[model samples]
Target: MDSNDVRRQWEARSGEYSPEYYAYYGPNDTSDALRCIFEQFLEPNASVLELGCSSGRHLSHLSVHGFENLAGIEVNPDAFDVMAETYPDLAAEGEFYLDAIEDVVTDFDDGEFDAVYSVETLQHLHPDAEWVFDELARITSDLLVTVENEGDVDRDGSTEPDVNYVNDDFPLYYRDWNTIFTDRGLVEVDAREGQRDTIRTFRTAQ
Candidate 1:
C-alpha cells in the first residue's frame, strides 16, 4: 500500500491497536527496558522523542522515572485525546505532534533531540518513506534506539519478502536496525534479542 494510505489507515484505527487499545496495555517489559536504557545512558533532563507514542504509554514510564523532557509523534488524533485522559501528566508536559512521523519529523532541525527512540514503530514505515530513517539519525544528537519485532519469518529475516502484510492489512518492513543506523553514521553500541523484539542502541560516533 502507498505510504499515505498506510498513514490514513493507522490514523483511523480504533478499538484494536488504537490509542486507547495500546494505552490499555500500559507499561510492560519493553517499557522497563527502555527506562533502564535511559537511566543508565542519559540524564533526567535529556531531550527524548518517541516516534509513535500511542497514548504516551512508554513515555509515561520515562516521565515517572524522572525524565522531564519528552515529546512524541503519533498519527492518530484520538491518541492525544486518550493520552490526555489517561496519562494526564505526560499529556501536560510532553510536546506532542498529532501527525504522521514522516511529516512531523522533517521539520525538526539536525541534532534537535538528545535521544530518539521508537517501539515497534519504524517497522510500519512504508518503504516509500524509508528515507525517514536518515532523518531519524540526523535529528538525534546523542543516542538512537529501536525496539522492534525486527523479523518474523527467520532469525535474520533475510528470506522473507521486504514488506510483510499483517493480517492481510498494513505493512511491516523488515530491517536490520544495527546496519541501517550504522550506515547512516551512527555506531551500534548495544544489541539484545527478546522473544518479540530486537533492541538496538546506537550512538553518534565521536
Candidate 2:
C-alpha cells in the first residue's frame, strides 16, 4: 500500500485507540525495563523524534523524565488531535507533524535529532518500503531504535484478539533488522529480546 492507503487505515482506527493502549509500557504502572533501557541512551536534553508516535504516550513519558526536546510524526489526524488535546504542554513544547514517515524527511535537515526511535511502528510499513529506513537514518545523528515483533507473521486486517483496540484493515510487515539496517551501513549496538518482541539499537557504522 502507498502512503495514502496507510493513512486511511490508521485514520479509520484512530478513535478506537486510547491512552490505555500503552498500558504495557507505562512508566509507573508496569515493567520499567523499557524505560530503563531508554534512560541508558537518551540524555536529559536529547532532541528525540518518535516516528509513528500515536497519542504521544512515549513522548509524555520522556517529558516527565526531563527529555526537553521531543518531537513526533503521525499519519493519522485523529490520533494527532487526541495527542494535542490530551498533552497540551508537550504538544506546545515539541513539534508533532501530521505526516507520513515516508514523506516527512523533507521537512527537516540532516542530523536534526539526537535520536530517532519507534516502538512497534516500522513493522506496519509495507515489506518493500526500505526507503523509510534511509529517511529515518538521514535525520538521526546519534542513534536509531526500533521495538517490534520480528518473525514471519504477515497478516492483513484487524489486529489479533489480544489488543484492546481494533486496528482494522492494517497490514503487518515484519522486517529483518540485520538485513535492513546493516545493509544500509548501520551497525547494531545492542539488542534485547522480550517475550513478545525485540528491541534493537543501531548507529551509523564508523
Candidate 3:
C-alpha cells in the first residue's frame, strides 16, 4: 500500500484506540520504558515537540509533571481534536495538523525547541526512514527520544509489521540503537529493553 493508503488505515484505527484503555495501558510494558526515559532525559518546564502525540498520552503525563510548553503533530484530525479538547491548558489548539509528515512544515527557527520525541511511529514511515530522520534532525536542538519494537521480520516478501503501530512496507530496522543513530551524529546516551520494545535516548553533539 502507498502512503495515502497507510494513512487511511491509521485513521480508521484511530477511532478504535481510546485514551482510557489503549493509549495508556494497551501497549504492554513499553510505557514503563518510556517513562524511565522521560524522567531521565526531559527537563522540567522544557519546550517539547512530540512527533506522534496520539491522543496526548505522553503530553498529559508531562504536563502533570510540570512541563507546560508541550506541542504535538498528529495526522488524524479527530484524534487531534480530542487531544486538544482534553488538554486545553497544555495543547495548542489547531497546532496538530492532519497533513503527512513530509508535508507538515515544522518551520521552527533554528534551535527553537529543546527536545523532539517519537514513539512507535518511525517503523511505519513510508518511502523508508530518510524523511523521518531528516525531520527529527531539523527540529531538535538537544535531545531525541525514540521507542520502537525490536523484532526480526520477513522483509523481502511479506510487508507486514511485527509491531502493530509500524508500517510493514518500509521494513522496520530493529537493530541496536547505537548502530542506528551513530552515523547521524547522535550519541546514544541510554537504552533499555522492555518486554517487547527498546527505548533509546540520544543527545546531539555540541
Candidate 4:
C-alpha cells in the first residue's frame, strides 16, 4: 500500500482510540515501563523525537517527567488533532508533523535529534519499505528505541496485510533488529522481552 492508503487506514481507526487510552497522566504498566526505559536511556534534557507518536501520549508523559525537548511525527491527522487538543502544551512547545515515517529525512536534518523512538509502531509499515530504517538512522544522533510485535503466531506465515488487534487493515512485519540496525551501524544497547512483544534499544556504533 502507498502512503495515502496507510493514512486512510489509520484515519478509519481513529474513532476507536481516545485520549484516555493514550493518557499520560494516569498510572499504567505500559507507561511505567516506558518511563523506566526513558530514565535509563534518555538524558533528562534530550532532544527526543517519537516517530509514530499517536495522540502524543509519550510526549505528554515525557513532559511530566521534566524532559522538555520533545517532538513527534504522526501520520494520522485525526490522531494528531486529538493530541493537539488534549496536550496543547506539547503542541505549542514542540513540533508534531503529519507525515509518514519514510519521508522524515526530508522533514528533518540529519542527526536532528538526540534520540528517536517508537512504540507499537513500525510493524505497521508496508513490508517493502525497509528504506524507513535508513531514514530513521539518518535523523537520529544517538539512540533508537522500538517496541514491536515479534515471534511466531497462528498467522505468522502469512505475508499479507490483515486486520490486527486494533481493527486496522495494516500489514505487520516482524523485523530482526539485530541484523537491520547493525547493518545500518547501530549496535544493540539494551533489550527487554515481554509476552508478545519486545523493546530493543540501540546506539550508534562508535
Number of clashes found in candidate 4? 0
Model 2 over residues 1-206: C-alpha lDDT tens digits?
Answer: 56567556765653234333542334332124445655887787888888888778778877877778888888766665666677777878888888777777667898898888877778777644556777777887888888877764443532331122114456656567756787777889888887766888888754
Q: Which tens-of-lDDT digit does each residue in 111-172 have in candidate 3?
A: 56778777766656654434456567767788887777757554454334343333333334
lDDT string for model 4 (98-199, tens) is: 777776556678898988888777777765566788888888888888877765545454544343534444656666666678789998988888766788
Query: Over the stretch 141-187, how does candidate 1's per-residue lDDT look in tens digits?
Result: 99998998777555454523377788888888887777788889999
lDDT of each: 0.90, 0.70, 0.62, 0.73
Whose lDDT is higher: candidate 3's or candidate 4's? 4
How big is the positional error of residue 195 in model 3, measured in Å on the Cα after superposition? Answer: 1.9
In model 3, the worst 10-residue window by lDDT is: 161-170
lDDT for model 3 comes to: 0.62
In terms of TM-score, the best-performing candidate is 1
State the TM-score for model 2. 0.80
- Each model's total of backbone clashes: 0, 0, 1, 0
Q: List the residue pairs that clash in candidate 2.
A: none
User: Which stretches of candidate 3 lie above 4 Å from their native place?
Assistant: 15-35, 84-88, 92-95, 153-177
Q: What's each prediction's TM-score?
A: 0.95, 0.80, 0.76, 0.83
Clashes of 3: 1
